[model samples]
Every structure is written in structure tokens, then in C-alpha cells.
Target chain A: MKMKCRQFFEEFGVTRMIAVGFFLAIAIAVPVLHLNTLTLYSQALTRMAMNGVLVLTMVPIMVCGAGMNFALPIGIICGLIGGLISMNMNLQGFTGFFASILFSLPFSLVMGYLYGLLMNRVKGSEMMIATYVGFAVISAMCIVWLFVPIDNLVLRMQMGRGLRKDVVLTDFWAGILDDLCPVTIGGLTIPLGTFLFLFLMCFLVYLYMHSKTGIMMRAAGQNPGLAAANGINVDRMRIWGITLSTVLGAIGILVYAQSYGFMQFYESPKMMSFSAVAAVLLGGASNKRASIFNVIFGVMVFQGILTLSMPVANVLLPESNISDIVRMIISNGIILYALGKGSGKK
Target chain B: MKTIKQFFSENLVVIFFALLCLGAYLIAGQAPYVVVSDLINRVMRNSILVLALIIPIMAGMGLNFGIVVGAMSAQAAIILITHWRMTGMAGIVVALLVCTVISVICGYLLGMLFNKTRGQEMITGMIAGYFGNGIYLLIFLVLFGTVIPFWDEELSIRSGIGIKDTLKMIDGMKGAMDNVWKLQLSQVLIAVFVLYTLYMAYCIVKRGRENRSAVKISVIKWLIWGAALAAVLLIPSVSAVVTRCKIPMITLFFVILVSVLCQFITSTKLGQDFRSVGMDIGIAEASGINVNRIRILATIFSTVIASWGQLAFLQNMGTFSTYTAQQNVGTFSIAALLVGGASIDKATVRQAFIGVVLFQLLFLLAPSAGTKIFNDTQVGEYFRTVISNGVIAVALVLHALNKNRKKAAQADSI
Candidate 1:
């Protein structure tokens, strides 16, 4: 029993332990400090839904032994393009949201395929190279966003050449999913539509993982040499895994834009990958393996810290934005620990 | 015929770069003086940072992507020194001293972590850089006023809690080193020729002592290199371009000395151990080398040199965007080195120099070239970024592919 407990602790990690402690402490203090518990929990729930899918996007690629998908920005940019084009066409309500999804499909597919090919060529150094690829894509898009000549006046700047840095979605698909079926128990509102969407994704991923192809991907990830010897197309599986992960990333960002009500471009999506990478890692996933449970749990914990630490820190120290500092430290520190641990085991 | 094929295969990337430069020159239609001057200045400024990359590559750490950490440490030290009202060479020296100490500690920890991680060193280094950046920012932004306590309000943000985004070095130690002793183009060329002749003679003597027949071969190789460099210098158009670009002779000397020191160190026992450990850890371990210790030493050397490079870079610029200046040190330098045709397993001082010149020259011309071709300078900006990043990615991909091919060939042989 003692050994089992030690093993559990070893797997659980001290950073997560401290993170859990902070979460619980904040939960208790929210009520004690006369803060709106309902509002805090509600915000946490929304934030979790907002970030959950992006974190989940890591599972397929990680299962294929590609580590975290640092090239998430590529998928994100595709989604942004799709969403902007849909908005430019002035698609509205649920029609606009789904239209954005449909539009992003081809973009995501092509980008994911090319990115996968590049990743395959640079197998061992995927993470590092993926990072630069993402950077290069975003920067290249920076030029594209300026010169693409979109006709929508709202999307473009007043000078009429470049895209605006931030496009308001207030007139578009803002809160389409979140407001679809919100349940308010006291002030603790549950975004039922968002939760349903997340559940649907989770169910699909779970079903896929149980399929023969998914099993092959997992086997390849676990032991590529054995999989190769057994005649599984490991490279093809990895490419597909990257493709699916990227498609999910596109959908994830569309959801983010709908809820957040702003379509930010250029450099906006640059640092989005790090937080999601950290969140999935926080859920006890490593470079080789992750599960749906890890995704849900990681998003909850990661977003909880970002959500609660603010009000709590504000109450505790009203002089500064201590919560932002705490967020940076905890998130980055967790990632650093994960990266170091991942390396150590290998 | 075999030699021709070998040359083409070996230098495909360099050939491509040369073509790219030619194309850029044609598109740019800028004065040669403008391009040459910019290239010279940039080469002098950025070469040291690229040189800092050589040690880690020699030790087979792939690339020191964590050199950004050293740069951050240097920036932090510079900020502190500036705030303390230190000026001129004194301030620069103090900053360098502080950063060196800080970087050694950071590098030791990084090296130890890398040792644990082993094959994941490159990714680990990249992530470690971001992780270190977070902490560095926290300190500079939050702790400087609260815990650390800085007195200079000018350097601090309006909140008095963080460092300003841009810190001017005009009042402190701007161009202190570069201004020490500048040299004319003719004088610099003559000096370089003299040095090269002496070095070649020494090489001939040393090779003659070791293997009598090697003397003639060494002499021939020296003559070839000398001829190529001389050809560039002797052509009137190229000479006009070179002479128009006044050299920072002092800084050039320092860069050369460091490069020589690096070359010399590789001949030492420690450097040999590093080379062995870098080549194959299993074999190196069996051969009784302390692989981890040597790796750690290599990282320490790299990080310290990178710190010095950052100092030199900022001193020459005379100011810095405090938060952003050190961020791309690893990226640009690594890209430059790769562009110069160095791979993950191999790098040299020659590669660093050639890489800096070619890479920065492309950077210099790209904007105008883009403007001329596409009617938008932003295209040039994005093009350069794409090319820089594309080069690194392509190099990494090629290296991995080459490794796999080698492994397959070995399997076939078996």
C-alpha cells in the first residue's frame, strides 16, 4: 500500500498537487471572502469549455508519439480564415457557426497534411520544428492578412487594405453555443450547449480510439518498431493523427471565437498553444499517452486556476494583478516540470 | 567527374543561397555600398552570437536553443547596471561579469536537466528557454520594484514595478567597444592577409613535423583559400565595395581571437572528450570519458559566451528593447548557422562567419527586393522570416532523413 501510494504520488506530480491545493483553497475562500461563488464557478465552467477542446486536440497526436501539437496555430489560423470568410459572407446565428466549421474543413485538411508531411520528415525533432513551422506560418499569414483584399468592410481596416487586429463578433455568432441552453442553478450557470458540444467531441474521440485504426495508431505510438515489423503503416497513421488533431483544433478555435465574441488575428493566436499544452500536461498526460479524462480534468484544473486566482488575488492583494503573475508562474512552471520529466523518463 | 558531382552534392544549399543573393541583388537594384555596408556592420554585430552556438554543436547537443536564457540573463544584468548609474566601459564590464556568473549557474542547471533528458535535448532546450523567460519576466516586471528594489525611476515602468520596454544606452555604455579602434578597409585587409599568411606558415610547420608529406597538401589548401579570398578583395568592384565599408577592427579582432581560442580548445584533452562524447555516448562511456561532465562544461561555455555576445550586441546598438531584444537570439543565430551549411552534428568558426555574412546580407536585401518585386516591403519582411525559419526546418528534416538513410544502409550491409 505504501509503495502504491508512493507510485501514485510519483505519477501525480508535486506541481499538480500544489495546483490542486491552490484550487481547493480558492474554492473555500471564494465563499469565505464574500465573493460570488456562483459567478466564479460559472466563469470557471465557461472557461473550461472554452479551453477544453484545444487541450483535447493533443490526445490524438500524443497517442501517435508526436508529443504535444505545437503546430496548433496552423489549425487555428485556418479556423480564423474560415470564420472570417464566413463572417464576410454574413452568415448568421447557428448557420454562421456551422458554416465557419465547414469552411475551415478544407483549410485544416490541407494545412494538417502538409504539416504532417513536414513532421514525418523531421520525426525526432518534431516539437522544435513544429514550433518554428507554426511561427513561420503565422508570420506569413501576417502578410497575407494584410494583402488578401477581403471585401467585408467590418473585417478590413478603414484604410481598406489590411485586416483589423480585432474583429467584433457581436453582430455575428457571439455566444451562439453558450447561450443555446444555459442552466442557472442560483448564479452557477451551466453552458449546456458548450458541455454538449464537448461531450460529443469526447464521445467521437473515444469511439475512434477503440477502433482498429485508432488501435493501430496507439500501437505505433507505444512501439513503432514493433508496429512497423507487424506491417502497420506508422507514418500514415501519424499523419492521420496530426490531421484529426488539427481539425479538432480548428473547431476548438471557432468555439473560442463564438464564446469570446472576438476574432483576433495576426499575432493574437501566437501564444495560444502554450496554455493548452500546459493544460493537457497538467491532466497527467505525457509525450506518449493521454486520455479523454486527462483532457477534461486538465482543462478544468488549468482554467480553474486562471479563473479563480484572479478574484482571490484581487481580494487578497488589491494593489496589483498578482493573479496574472501567478498564472504565468504556475502554467509555465508546470510545463517546465512536464518537459523535464518527459525527458528524464526517456 | 566524381569531384564535380561531390562538390555539387556537398554545396547544393550554399549554391542555392548564392543564387538567392544574386536574385535579391537584381531585384533590389540598390547601391552596392548600402548592401555591403549593412552586411559588414551586421556581420560584426551578430557573428559572436553565432560563434556562441559552435560549442554546443561540437558537443553534439544539436543546437543550443536555450541560449535565449543566457541572453535574458545578460539583459537583466544590463538593466541592473544601467539602473546603478554605471557608465562607459565600467558599466559594460560590470554587466558582463554579472551576466557570466548568472549564465553559468543557469547553464549548469540546464545542462544537468539536459543530461537527464538526453535525446530530447533540443525540444527541452526550446521549452526551457520559454520557461526561463517566464521567470525572467516575472523578476524584471514584478520583483524589480517589490522585492529587488530599483532606484532608477527612468528605467522602471510607470507602475514602478517593472522595467521599461525600451532602455536607452546613450547615457550608459553605447558603442564603447566598437568605437575603441576602427580601421580603414585597406589596413584591415592587409592585416588579415598578414595574419592568414603567418597562420598558414605555422600550420605548414606543424604538419611538416607530424607528417612530412602533409606539408605540401597543407600549403596547397592554404593557397586555394588565400586565392579565393584574394580574388574577392582584388576585383576592383568588390574592393570598392569592401573599402567603402569601414570595419570595426577591434571587435573583429575580439571575434577572431575567440574563434581561435575555440579552435585551440578543441585540440585540448577536454575538447577531445567533448568530441568523443558528442559522437557516441555509449562508446564514449566505454572509453572512460565522463560524458555528462563534458556536456555540462560545453553548455557552460556556450551559455557564458552567449551572454557576452548579447552584451556586445546591445553595446553596439547603444539601446535595447528590454523585453524583446533577447527573445530571438537563439532563433536567428541558429538559422544563420544552418544557412551557412552547418548541420546539427557539425559546425565550425568558418561556418559561423560565413553564415552571419550571408544570412544578414539576405536580411539586408530582402526588404528592398520584396518592395521591388511585390511592391510591398512587408512581403520582404515575411519572406525573410519564412526563409530563415524554412532553412532551419529544412536542415532539421534533411538531417533526420540522412540519419534514417544511414541506418537503413547499415541494415542493408548487415
Candidate 2:
């Protein structure tokens, strides 16, 4: 029994253990702090579904050995462009949401290919370079956002030529997924449509991973030399992996924006990659290997902690952004732990 | 002509930035004196932080983004001294001592972490920086008034549970170094020239006694530098600008001291170890150098210097946003260093100084240039962000490409 317990701890990983422990702590704290448990659970579920795809974006890149997709803002920016175009054309509801995804596909594909090429060049230093690339793209887009030529008065700033910092989506596709088939039971609400969408993406990704191309990509990532010896075209596999991750990122942001009821521009997307990276890591993904299970499990625990911690922290501290502080701690702490684990070779 | 072309190609990054600075300056249409004074102030404030990056890069750590941890330590020290009501140079000294202790501890732990994440130190350091910030926030925000029993109306929020967003430095702490021994820019320049001549004369004499051939080269270099200084003084408009600006002598002295120290450290045995480790870990380890220990030492050195640099920076600024002040230190400093032509595996004090000037000059000019060209100040701010991040990204890509070429060349040769 003692040996089994030790073995379980060893295989569970410290990051996931801590994250699980923290999640449980927050879960217990919620009712004790006199917060609405049912409301918190509903919000947590909504958050999990909303951020699910973004967290899912990590698996392919990690599997294909490009490291964490720290340049998530690249795909995110592409999505924003697509969303802006759709909004400009005054598309609404599911049509608007899907149109945004469609418009974003071409951009994400091209950008992802180019980004993959860049990653191929900087083989070992992808994460650091990807981070700066993301930063550069975000800042460059700050200038681009100023003169995007989107004519929607609703999206654009009232007094300026630029888009507003937060473009409201109420008239468009706000809660389009969440409200699609929300189920309420015992005062707990479930965003069924969002969950279904998330699961669909997860299933597609799972199928792709089990396919021939996906297996080749994973083999290439696991050992590029061996894959190249086997004539696997490792570089191309990586590009495919990155392109797929970028597409998911673009889709993820649209889902996030719709659920949050606003599309945040400029610097807001800067740190989004870190949280997604952390969430995937928290769900038991290593530096070089991740899965659909990690995506689903990680988002739930990570976003659950985020949702539950806010009100609990507010109640405990009273008038402080202690929740943001906690978030910075937890997300970054998990990332640091995973990075320090040294490529998950064990 | 070939030599000139070689120089341009070799110094492409620096030359490119120099041109960008010149273009921005012209577009902004600022008075030379104003630009000169602002550049001087910025260089003095920021150069040390840029210089602090050199040791870690020498040790092959590739841009110590965890210097934010050092900056935080300095802030913590400053906050403590302010709370204690320590004032004047004594206060500054107390803060420095406190900062040194805290940063050394932080750097040591950071070094250990870097050891575990060897190949991915830069990204690890970046994440660790965020993690450190989280802990720092927790201390000031939650642990301070509640667990630690710290309280002051001015320092704490109204709820008395956390520190406020911005903290004003006590009057004596502000300008503590800059106000001491101020000199006109022209005077400072002439003084520096005289000092340079004296040093050159001593070098020549020593070399003459030794009958070394290098004395002539030293003399020629001295003459060229003297001529350059004379030409600047001889130009009436430049002279007027120089005379109009006041040099913070003490602050300038500290910056000079750091550069000299950096130069001196590189010639030492430990510096050679840093170079070997940075160049090739296997060879360095084979050669009996404890690569990990040396890397840790390099990190400690960097973190300590960065703490002092942040001290110099905050003292000059007088007021700082408590939570957000250290956020951009690593980014701006790394960007400045790279702009000066330093690479991931190599950096120099000269590059650090040059990068600080060029980076700060562009920063000073960009907004005005943006306002002039685009009629939007926000455009200029965005442009600055783009340039800073874009430069680093370009540098990283170029470095990676260079490494790939080198690796391919080796593979072909093999």
C-alpha cells in the first residue's frame, strides 16, 4: 500500500498534484466562505468550456516538438482580424461566429506556416523566440489596430480612428454557444453547446493524433533524427503541427470572445498564451507530450480554480485584486515547475 | 572602401539603429539640447541595467530575463527604507545594502533554477520572473498587513490590507545621487578627455619601459579619440548644447565605474571560465570548469548589479508605480543591449553603453516622430513597443540562423 501510494505520487507529477490540491482547497473554501456554490460551479463550467480550445492548442505543438506555443497571439491576432471583418459585414449569431472562423482559417494557415518555418530555423530555442515573436506581432498589431479600416461604428472608438479597446459583441454572437442549450439542474447551469463544441474539437484532435500523419508528426517530434532516417519529413510535420495549433488558437479566441461578450484587443492577448500553457501543463501534460485528456482535465481544474478563487478571495480580502495575484502565482508557478522538470524524460 | 564596407557589414545592427535614431530625431524636430539632455538622463538611468545583462550572457544563459527579480528586490528594499523613514545618502546606502542581500538570495535561487532548466534558461527565467512577481505581490498585497503586521497609512491601502499602487519616495531619497556634484556637460567632457589622456600617457610610459610595439597603436587610438572630442567642442552649436546640459557627476561616475568593472571582470580567470562555458558546455566541463557553478556565479553577479542598477534608476525617477515598475526592466534592458549589437552568446560593456544611448534616443524621439508623422501620440508609443520587441525578435532569429549555418557548415565538413 505504501509503495503504491509513492508510485502514484511519482506518476501524478508535482505540478498536477499541487494544482489538484489548490483546486480542492478552493472548492472547500467556496461553501465555507458563504459564496454561491451553484453559481460558482456554473461559471467554472462556462470558463472551462470557453478556454478549453485554447488549452487544447498546446497539444499538437508539444507533440510535434515546437515546445509551448508561446506565440499564441499570432493565431489570436488572425482570429481578431477575421472577427473584425465579420462584424464589419454585420454578420450575427452562429453565422457570424462561423464566418469569423472561416475568415481566420486562411490567415492562421499562412501565418502558422511562416511561423513554423521560423521555428524550424531556431530548432532548440523555439519557445523564447516564439515569445518575442508573439510580443512583436502584438505590438505591431497595436499600430495595425489603429488603422484597420473597419467601418463598424460599434467596434471602432467613438472619438478616434482606431478600434475600441473592448469591442462589444452583444448585438453579434455574445453567449451564442453558452446559451445554445444551457441545462440547469439544482440551480447549477451547464453551457452544453460550448461543452459540445469543445468536445468536438477535442475529438477531432484525438482522431488526427491517431491518424498516420499525426503518428508521423509525433514520431518526428519524439526523435527528429530517427524520423528523418525513416523518411518522415520532420520539418514538414512540425509545420503541420504548428499550423494546426494556430488554427485551434484562432478558433479558441473566437469562442473566448463570444462567451466573454467582448473581443479584447492590443495588450490583453499578450499573457493569454501563458495561462493556456499553464492549464495544459496543470492537466498532466509534460514539455514534450500532451493529450486530449490533458486538455479537458487541465482547463476544468485551471479555470475552476480561477472562477472559484475570485469570489472567495474577494470575500476573504474585501476590495483587492488578490485573485489576479493568485492567478499569476498559480499559472506561472505551474509553468516554472514544468520547465524545471527538464523536458519530462523520466 | 573595402575596410569601410567590412565595418558596415560587421556593425550592421548598430549602424541600422544609428540611422533609425537619426531619422527619428530629424522627423521629431526637437532642439539638439533637449534631445542631448534627455539622452544623457536616460543613458545614465538605464545603462547599468543593460550592463548588468553582460555577465549572464557571457556565461551562456542568453538574456537573463529574471533580472526582474533583482529589480523587485531593489523595490522591496526601497519600500522598507521608506517605511523606516531613512533619508539622504544614508538612506540610499541602507537601501543598497538591503537590496544587495535580498538580490543575492534571489539570484542564488534563480541560478539553481537555471541549472535545472539548462538549455531553456531564457524562457524559464521569463516564467520564473512572473512567478517571482506573483510572490512579491502576495507579500505586499496579502501577507504584509495581515501576517507580517506592517502598517502605514501612506504605504498601505485604505483597507489597510495591502500596499497602494504607487508609492512616493521621501524627498531626501529622491535625487540622492544626481544632486550631488553636478557638472556642466562640456566640463564633464573636458574632464573625461583629460583623464583619458592621463591614462593613455601612463599606458604608453609603461609600454615604453617594456619596449612593447603596442604603444604606438595605443597612441594612435588616443589621438583619434582626442580629435573626436576636440571636433565636438570646436563645433559652436554642439558646444552650446553641451554647455547648456548639466551632468549628474555622481550618477555618471557610477555608470563609468560599472563599465570599467565589467571590462576588468572579463579579463579575470572566472571570466574565461564564463566564456568557455558559454561557448561549449561539454568542452568547458571537460576542461575542469564547474559549468553549473560558474553559471550560478554569473547569475548572482548579474542579479546584484541589476539590483544596484534599479536603485540608481528609481532614485533618479523619484516616484514609481509600486506593482508595475519592475515589469518592463528586463524587456527594455534586453532590447537596448541587443540594439547595441550584442548577441545571445556575446556582449560587451561598449555595446551595453552604445545600445543604451541608441535605444533611449529612439525611445525619446519615437513618440514625437509618431505625433509629427501620424498625428497620433499613441501611434508613436506603439511604434516604440514594436521597435523594442521587434528588434529582440529579429536579433533572436538572426542569431538562430547564424547558428544553423554554423552547424550546417560543421556537418558538411564532417
Candidate 3:
């Protein structure tokens, strides 16, 4: 019993340490710097709303025993492409958002399916493969974007490239969701529409995780051969899982692009995995498991940390980009602890 | 016909690389400029950096994605040398020593890590590389110069914490090896060929060495170890010589020696044990091989060599990107290794050299070639970055395809 307890402590201790460090650092930082918590809190919240969705997308693949969704940006890129197309197609307001999402859905499905097929072939080394594949595909698409020929005078720079790395989404769908029922009281503001969208996605994901198919996802993650023996079409489950991840990733990017007011190009979406992965893990999602609550909490806490720490660090260090160091350490340290956690074997 | 087809099949990627280079030249269109010399210079300077990746591959430990440690070790050494304000070849020698010590420690830790997670070495390494980078940052960004000790006050950041971003590595020993003798024969390239020949001869002599009486084994080991130490001491001093410039041949030679030693050690009784442990951990254990110890040793060697290579790389490049350097090295180096015909669990020195050469060649050629053809410099820039990454992806896909096909055929036979 004592040994078992020790083992349990060992496992939980890793998670507990990150949680403690995060809170403790923030706790000490808040008092030490005496900066405005609300400003930082709001920024973190905004980042969470934008990025939380991507972190949530990791569940399906992970549940299916596939690696972390390193290629989450592929789907996000598709969504960005969709927004670009729809905006050019003159889709506006609610119809524009739906149409844009609709435009991206099929692309996401196909891309996800292809990714799933590849994932199946490379059973082991999925994470590294996914990482490289993500990079390669993004870079390839970056080149292809040069010739995408969306002949809108504004969209196309005078030099005749497809679009700038960042395409302003202002006239398109920027702040559409954020402004929907956005409430303000005593310097506290909530982007209600964005939160509503998040809530809906979260609830749906929670429900999906509880469903019969969700159990198969769990099984697929744990033991594919065993799952197959038990009559689950393990490949199909993985395909579906990867598909779900891509779809969620697509929506997540749409939320982000819409909020940020522009689509930053190749490099823009490149950092998705880092920020999303960091947020989820920071919120207490391990590589293999996470909850909807974890998603929300992860995004919130990660954003909260990011938001509050920057100004506070500046106050103390007198350096502008002080948050970068903090963010870097927090994200990487969280990942290391997560990697070091669990069975304690590589 | 079958032999020809088999040769073509085996050398498909190399063929592709050759064709791509040809196509690049053709597309660049009759350029009278001797670009080859510049390219050769690149190959000479950076080739060793890539060559440093060969050992772990030979040991079936995959590409030394843990090269960041080695690179960091190199950085630490160079920093120390510069701090001492050692001018001429002595700086290079000192840097090399610093690199070796740091690499050994780093490699030992990394190797032990890999031993724990046996089968999943690559991703374990990839993460370990990143994690190492974090620690590197913690030390370099927060500790060095201020706490870690340094000779020059200018080396530290303005905040009096951590080392500064870019320090001139070339002032003391920058192109030491490349500048060997300035024999008007591109000494670096010529020497590379010589080393290549020596390496091949070593392999041929390896069979002879094996045939030598078992009585000679310990004698050979002591001789080699002693020679290695003597050279380690002597090389830096020779590099310190100002006759034809401070040639850091010793540092470069040490790397080559380490690679050769690692290869030799692996084929020895201990190496066979390593091979066995890698092939089957349980069987190795049952067979009386101390799997843990073997793993620990192999891990140490791999990580240490990785550190050395990385340091050698930083010594050459002079500037480090702080957080990004190791991660970049791990990704690009691994990709290059895979491109050079290394598989998931197998690699050779020949392949490492070939990979680094071809990969670096492609890296250099892509931008020039891209702009020549596409007229868009960004295309060239993006292609070089993306293609190196793409090569890794393509290699994995091919590896997967090969693996899955073999398994399916076996299943069918069963």
C-alpha cells in the first residue's frame, strides 16, 4: 500500500509541481510587481479563446492512441484558406462565417483522411513524423499560395503574389463573434459570442467523449491490437479520431483568425502547436488524456499567465519582451514534466 | 540487368539528389562563375558538423537528434577560449577540449535517457534535445558569465546575467582546420578525401585487426586510447602554430577519430553486446549481457559525440541562436542523415558524410537555384527551409512504406 501510494504520488506529483509552480510564480509575481491583473487576465482569456480550441482538438487523436496533434495547423491553415476564399467570394456576416467554415470542412476532412492514412502506415514514430510532415506540408502550401490566383486587387499585392503573409480580416469576419453580445461592466468585459462558441464546442466534445465511439477512441489509444480483437475497426476509429481533431482544429483557427482580425501567413500558424500544446498541458492535459474542463482551464490559465506576466515582468526587469522568457520556460518546463511523468519509461 | 536494377533501386535517392543538382545547374544556366569552389568550401566547413551525427546511427540509435548537447558543449568551450582571449591556434585547441568535456557529460546523460526508453529512441531524443535547449537557455540566458565564470567582461549580456548572443569564434580558432597549411590545394577538401581514404582503409584493416590474435586486443585498446589523448593535447598546440596560419586540424581529426573509434568499439565484443541489446533487450539480458550498462555506455557515447559535433558546428558558425540552435540542428541533421540513406534504426559513417554533403549541398544550392529558376528569392528561401524539412518527412514516409510492406508480406507468408 505504501509503495502503491508512493507510485501514485510520483505520478500525480509531476502534475502537482507544474500547478504549484504556475500558481506560485503568478502569486509572487502579482504582489511583487503590483501590475494590473485584469489587463493580463483579459489578454490570457483572449488567447485562450483563440488557442484553447486547438488544444481541445488534440483529444481525438490522442484518444485513438495516435500521438499528439502536431499537425493541428494543417486543418487551421485550411480554415484560413477557406476564410480567404469566402471573403473574396463576398460572403459576409453570419453567412460568411458559416460559408467560410463550410468551405474549409471538406478540405479538413480530406487532409485529415490523408494524414490518417499516413499515420496508419507509420505506426511508431508518429510524433516525429507528424512534426516533420506538418512542417513540410506547411512549407509546400506556402509555395502554392504564391500562385493561388485570387484576383482581387486588394488581396493580391501589386507585385502579384497570392497575398501578404498577413491578410487583414477586418472587412471580413474579425470581431464578429467577439462583438456578439459582448458585455462590459466596471472594466470587466466578456466576449460572449466567442465564449458561447467555445461553450458549445466544449459541451459537444464532452458529450462526444462520453459516447460509444468515444470509448472506442479510448480503446484505440490504449491498445490498437486489443481494440481490433474486440471487434473495433481500429483504423476506422483512428481515421474518425484524426478527422475530428482536424475539424475542431479548423474551427479553432477560424475563431482565432476572426478574433485577431487578420490571417498571418505560413509562420503565423506555425506556432499553433507550441501555444496550443502549452496551454493544454499548462491546464493539466497530459499527452494522452485531457478534458473539456482542462481545455477551458488550460486556455484560461495559460492565457492568464501569458497576459499577466508580461507587464509584470516589464515592471521588474524593465525589458519589453520579458514575457517571452517566462512563456518559453513555462511551456517547455510543462512539456518536460509531462514527458517525465507517468510510467517513467521513455 | 538485375544487378543494374538493384543498384538503381538501392541508390534511388542518391540518383535523385544527383539529378536534382544537375537540374539546378542546368536551370541556373551556363554560369561561368566557379560556384563549385564556394560550394566545396561550404562542404568542407560544415561537413564535419554533419559528420558528427554518424555514430548513434551506427549504433542503431537513430540520428543523433540529441546533437544540441554536443553543440552546447562546443559553445561552452568556445566561450571559455574567447574569455581567456587566447589568440591564434591555442584558442581552437582550448575550444575543442571544452567541447569534448561538455559533450561527454551531455552524451552520458542523453545516452542514459535513451537506454531507459529503448525502442522509442528518436522522439525521446527529439524531446530530450528540446529539453536540453531549455536547460541550455536557463544556464546561458540566466547563469553564464555572471555565475558560470568567464574571462572577458564584454561576453556577458548588459544585465550582467548570461552570455551575449553572438561572440566571434573565428578570431582565435574559427576556420582553423579549413585553413590547414593553405597548400593552394583546398586543403580542407583534399584532406577530406585523405580522411575518407584513411577511413576506408581503416574499415579494410578492421578485418585484419579482427584476425589478429585475441592477445592483441588490450594492447590495441591502450595504444589507441594513448594515441587519442596525445593527439588531443598535441593537436591544439600544433593548431597554435603560426607557420601557415593556426590550422585546427587536431580538432577536426579528433572528431574523425571519435567517429572511427565509436564504429570500432561497436564491432568489438562490447559493440556486439550493444547491437544485441538494441535488437532484443530481453534476449541480451538473458544472454548475460549487462543491458543496462551497455545501454548507459552507448547512450553516453552517442550524446557525447553529438555534443562534440554540435560544438564543432558552433565553433564554425561562431554565433548561436540561443534557444533555437540545438532544435534546428537536431531537425536538420536528422533529416540530412535520413536523406543520406540512414533508416530508422541504422546508419553508417559513409552515409552520415554523404548525407551531410548532399544535404548541405542542396541547402546551399536551393536558394541560388530557386532564384535562378523561379526569379522569386522568397521561393528559394522557403524552399531551402522547407526542403530540408521535407526530406525528413519523405524519408519517414519511405521508411514507413518499406516497413509496412515487409510486415504485410510476412503476414501473408505466415
Query: Taking the candidates in order, what DockQ does each have?
Result: 0.56, 0.78, 0.45
- Write model 1 residue lDDT over A96-195, tens digit each, in one string: 9999999999999998988888778777778877777788788889888878767778888875368898999988999999999999997789998888
Whole-model Cα lDDT of every candidate shown, in order: 0.85, 0.92, 0.70
Q: Against the hidden reference, what TM-scores do the models get? A: 0.92, 0.97, 0.86
Predicted chain B of candidate 1, TM-score versus the true chain B: 0.92
Ranking by lDDT: 2, 1, 3
lDDT of 2: 0.92
Per-residue accuracy of model 2 over A206-252 as CA lDDT, tens digit each: 99999999999999988899999999999999999999999999999
Q: Candidate 2: which pairs clash?
A: none
For candidate 2, the per-residue lDDT at A284 reads 86
lDDT of 3 by residue, A117-221 (tens): 989888766776887788887888788777677856667766846677777777777888888887666565677788888888888988998899999888877
Badly placed stretches (over 4 Å) of model 1 are A27-40, A117-122, A160-162, A226-233, A311-327, B170-172, B198-244, B412-414
The per-residue C-alpha lDDT of model 3 at residue A338 equals: 60
Q: Any runs in candidate 3 off by more than 4 Å, and if so which?
A: A1-11, A158-160, A320-322, A340-346, B30-33, B144-153, B186-255, B318-323, B404-414
CA lDDT, candidate 1, residue A320: 55
What interface RMSD, in Å and to 1 decimal, does model 1 have?
2.3
What is candidate 2's DockQ?
Answer: 0.78
Looking at candidate 1 chain B, the ten consecutive residues that score lowest on lDDT are B169-178
After superposition, candidate 2 runs with Cα above 4 Å error:
A344-346, B208-228
- For model 1, residues B235-307, the per-residue Cα lDDT tens digits are 9988888777788766787788778877788899988988998889999999999899999999988888888
Worst 10 residues of 3 chain A by lDDT: A337-346
